[model samples]
Target: MKKVIIPLALCLITAACGGDENDGKTEPEMKISSCYVVSSSSGQSENFSSPVGMYITSEAGQPYEGSGVWSASYNSGAWAMDKPVYVTKAGKVYAYYPYSSNDSPPVLPLDMTRQTDVLYSRVASPIAPGSVSLSVKLYHALSKLVVSVKGEEVTGLSLSSPVKCRFNICTGEFTDLQSGQVTSTDGRLFVVPHVTVGKEMIITLKSGKQYTYSVDGTEFRAGESYTYEFQLNEDRDKLEILDISVEDWINDNNYNDYLRR
Candidate 1:
């Protein structure tokens, strides 16, 4: 249960509406009594447990005025489907990610190798009876550093610099952020918070071995993903960078099956 304090203006706009004349028409649609909040994400399956918070403001008055905050939890398993979210006013709807109380942009963690789920979307309101769908696009705020060791048992791993990722909560977009050296015990993969293309990565193995990999020339786009395979060169005492590959974030091994559907 995340907590948030919305300004009264947004609250009023979403919760109710004031009586106003319409070109000589008598009654405005008595405030929007109910609505449905549908959620969708590009290249991803449905998240039935994720909730979305929103506010609907009337198009008649100042845009987004007097709207109150409301929450809608998604319960559907079908991708790109609409869920029910009740609203008092029938206007434009503003929706944000995580649906939790925290409206701030998401902070990418140091160890993203295990987790890489972050997405957000917004829908202009006036939510209809059943088809008020809010399409959310999940963006990868972090870049993947895959280090596949073929010869030696890796005892430890750490980056030469820490990667810091910054993104816009409103737009679900990642910015060009920098990273510093951060240590990690996760050897196979490093889910870095920031884009670390063309940077220096220092890897340390359990056998008291260290290798510095110059990130490939490929740039790490926000929504895209990349991989670096490293191996132990038998001819030499040090490690070697095998190869670097890039692909759409949705196509990573974690999403191979779902994206195909």
Candidate 2:
């Protein structure tokens, strides 16, 4: 079941929080300032770097059953929940968020697939697609890339809606959350999904190309934010860029609302 583009709903998302009257601290800011592209299991604050960090599991890609610190007693000297959560690979502190699971959390080793979302791509110009900041390091034992799409990434651009909210990082040809196609009216296409946190789309660009880019999402309950980033080819993968753009069959509003499903 594909989802049709809802201009009204999109307007609501893109315009949400712009004129809110609540206490207004603003949504979590969506910006997570880190030092390195890849996080290290053990290192100083300056030496440690990566997008997001948390104690992960070696076998299963999930958060470790790390309690003590999570208990909130760590600052008190003892271990407790709520205290800053740290991982080994980069020893970076992973922000804690309430999820569906609680018992035995799955901490992704080098690859935080459990916290990755959907990835998108399209050909706007002949130039390649990528970001400048590599939040997390591509740990051969972890993942190919660990990007963090903060508020700075998507500034002026409008976020339509929650296209895909997940943390599962996997390789695939993703569907657009807003239009579902690779191309838009003006020829500019949104290759990324409409969701955030828990998801990072990945794809190989033209054999040789590079570009600076950013990403963001609009949230009715929260404000809209963008992430400033850039991407360059790594020595790991040797695949050529899949610079395929989608047709305008999308955003038709009635093309196939069920297709996006």
Candidate 3:
């Protein structure tokens, strides 16, 4: 029988040396202040950066489980969780509510899209110095809707209700934050939907004459987007659905709702 010999150092190399893939590499670190310590019900806070508590998970596309620190601050002798995390790759940082647990990511309620109740996420990479103040911007996680009309005789348009609060935002999951609204003579209305179902919306279109259209059921999905285009035929007797397309809420229009706070 022949005996085979293995090197002890080689057997332990993977465990000791390769365990830390980010070793020696300059990794990005989230600023402790970037995570809001407290938020007001009105979505505005004067001491939003108090650093009272925060739970964060930094992952490269996959979900992670992490615990946050309470009373997190730059003060000496604080919990390790209070410290910033170093990143090996560009990814998302899901920050939980103050003193919240990381058993799961935060959930947006069905009615959370209301301006009075807005939640946000933090996205950034290469977390270098000054990046904390300059590159970091909060974003709302909701969907939006826009409607427009085109016709030779069309003069004005109005809806019985504001187009902003039409859908149920609780059903589907959303990835990005949403805000802003605009209306024009052509019937331009921007809305945010918190649910995935459709609603019966009534609209009045006016040109040389006035016409009413029942947008009986228009569906708005979460994390997804939509735009409705109503075209008036030559007779203008009926409004036709010229197009319904998906839109990227980020690049489309106003997101200054944060400024109001």
* Top lDDT model: 1
lDDT of 3 by residue, 111-141 (tens): 2323332334343223333353222223334
Candidate 1 per-residue C-alpha lDDT over 58-173 given as tens digits, one digit per residue, 9 for 90 to 100: 56633343324455543343332132334334555555433445343233222233243444343243554344444443344444555657765565555643445554544455
Candidate 2 at 234: error in angstroms?
43
- Candidate 2 achieves a global lDDT of 0.25
TM-score (all chains, Cα) for each model: 0.53, 0.21, 0.37
Q: Candidate 2: where are CA atoms >4 Å away?
A: 1-35, 38-51, 61-63, 66-164, 169-261
Query: Which has the greatest TM-score?
Result: 1
lDDT of 2 by residue, 1-261 (tens): 998787797788767756576644432211223322122334212212111222233223333334411211122322223333222232212332222234222221111212222111111101111221112222211111112222112112222223332232222222323322121222122323233433223322333222222223321111111222333346433222323222111122221121122
Give lDDT: candidate 1, residue 227.
64
If ranked by lDDT, best first, what sequence of candidates would result?
A: 1, 3, 2
Task: lDDT for model 3, please.
Answer: 0.41
Whole-model lDDT values for every prediction: 0.47, 0.25, 0.41
Residue pairs in clash, model 3: 140-177, 141-176, 141-177, 155-207, 168-194, 168-195, 169-194, 169-195
Poorest stretch of ten by lDDT in candidate 2? 120-129
For model 3, what is the error of residue 241's alpha carbon versus the real structure, in angstroms, after optimal superposition?
A: 2.3
